[model samples]
Target: MVTPCPSLGPPAPYVRRNVTHPASLSAWARLLGRYARCIRGRRRDENRKRGSGMEIHWSHVEEISEDERHAIEARLSALAAGHTDMIDLRIVGRGTGHHRHGGKEIRVACQVRGREIVAVRSADDLGLALDQAIDAFEREVRKLREIRSTHRDERPQNPPYLGIVDRVLHAAGYGFIVTDGGEKVYFHRNAVHGGLEFERLTEGDRVALNIEAGEKGLQATTVVPAPPGVPAP
Candidate 1:
């Protein structure tokens, strides 16, 4: 025979039962359905926000064909390849004037880096107008890129002042380098490197010059051909 163990403080209190009225149950079911729907809607909105990374706005002249729109999108994507920021494209089409022969106008504005680059064109034919506008837009984008590249903050390994060969006195073996900054520095034929000769240099020739203070003043100690591809000052 086995002895029964003593109860631990009688039996613990019974578990609480979840009791609800019919009306309450219905209200809870409805509340749960609404919550689920809200969750689904929020998810959809998030997905859409992710998918539409670029914001493109289109307006009247109704002249842009589907194919042309696609082409424009492709071009813009190429322009925005390296940029992770949002790109906004606003395109407008309208008549240049109210006159009978007034040409159509297509205007495109690209928002980049907190600046707006706008291109506009008017043509007798709608397609021609669109083409011209796109060309102009591309040119604007290219110009912006060039400006940014030139003004970028990165330091180069061997930075040199950009200048032009203003004057050359072959006999004296000395010449002046007129920097884009409008300052002039003196250089001698011996200072030119890379097989460059004072005799071969002409006025308005682009060059990169390294300057230092000499007994006379700031002098170009070294000069070369704008480092091959760099622009003159």
Candidate 2:
């Protein structure tokens, strides 16, 4: 005769006690939904703060108050306005040996188009030092923008023309070129192009160039070696 095991005889039915009503369940769901929305909103605000691309660092000093930090951030954002080339900015604050007397130093570094511009200032008060540093930083940024604008305005707009190096100031980093049409155009070391070394350039070297009217006078925006067998004009 075969015997049956006690564990396999029969399964017991499961019962849940104190079951929640449908209305209570709905209320809990709404509460949870509101909590989730609140969390998402906070995350968005934090993300916006990070997206500003500004950072502050403290060295041998305690962190500043939230009000001060906010003020600094606002100032930086205002300074960066309309400047799309700026990548990021960093501010560093340090306490001097006379920390008890409130001596502080502030440094601001700005990165723009792969270039770093920095400014440093020290004062009896941290706020004054920061203000001075920011003022210097703004001036540097404005100067850089002006220089870029000048370079853009100096870009050539016409085709290359044949010319001869009429004069070169080896110590001055500049020279003059006489074009085929007998027009003399000035060229700086920065204008040398086509892999040509400005240091190796000498008087009477045949070159091809594009000229434009500059703030001073006619200038060669680009300069390269002249092609072979090109008849001099």
Candidate 3:
């Protein structure tokens, strides 16, 4: 059996803090610091008053250092003429534009929290965008590096070329070679280096572009069989 004693004077107000680790304590300190300094008018509402999403407009990608500015311009051009419409651009650290540099009529997208521009992967690709609002150029280079590494690993020393048949619709006995992507390729009557023969070409043989793109989606410049064990070039 237990006896009921007098109640403690007003239950001590609940203290909600539950610090467990030093890192937690440090984090709490930093949060408290932010709360303390971010009082009153400007600091209090600065982050909250953004219109929708933040957008950084970088019009003067040029006018910077010759190399850096050119790099940014290259990225813009690639985006403008790339196949992928997506560019993971980020606005890591922004710099105030110069007198004749920025603050002009610029186009902006949703600005990212942190990132920068670098270089282009394949200048031959089509359908990217310019007027990029990028920050750093080096980071983009890292992306390029990763792509190259993957390409080197997956791609063969020599891949087959792709092209469209550029000859009469000869159903009987005629010859045609596919023009590789963006370039021109030669398809001799005996050029079908594959197990098949050139004479067996169909109208639209879907293939991978193993060549460079020339004026107006020109066919392959160097047409060849896709499989290995063909005669040397």
Which scores better on lDDT, 2 or 3? 2
lDDT of 3 by residue, 1-233 (tens): 89899888887888889759999989999998787455422321332233111112234334334355345445433433312112223322223343344433222332111122333221111111222334223345445556756876777655555445556344433334444434444332322333544455666554333443322332232334444443222
lDDT of 2 by residue, 1-233 (tens): 88866676557787768989999999999999899567545543443354433333434434556466556666666665544444446778887767655578888876554457899888887778878888898888889888989897576553469989999997766799999999999887656777688899988898998776654578775788888788777
For residues 1-233, write the lDDT of model 1, one tens digit per residue.
99999867876778988988899999999999899567545543443345423446678956677677667766666665545222457888887774464478888886544456788888788778777888898888788778867876674545368889999998666789889899889776656775676789998888887676654566775778776776643
- The alpha-carbon root-mean-square deviation between model 1 and the true structure, to one decimal in Å, is 21.0
Candidate No. with top lDDT: 2
Kindly indicate the candidate among 1 and 3 with the higher TM-score.
1
Error (Å) of candidate 2 at residue 43 is 12
Query: Which pairs clash in model 2?
Result: none
For model 3, what is the C-alpha lDDT against the true structure? Answer: 0.38
User: Which window of 10 residues has the lowest lDDT sum in candidate 1?
Assistant: 44-53
Show where candidate 1 strays beyond 4 Å.
1-52, 98-102, 154-233
Query: Which residue segments of model 2 deviate by more than 4 Å?
Result: 1-63, 98-102, 156-233
Clashes of each: 1, 0, 21
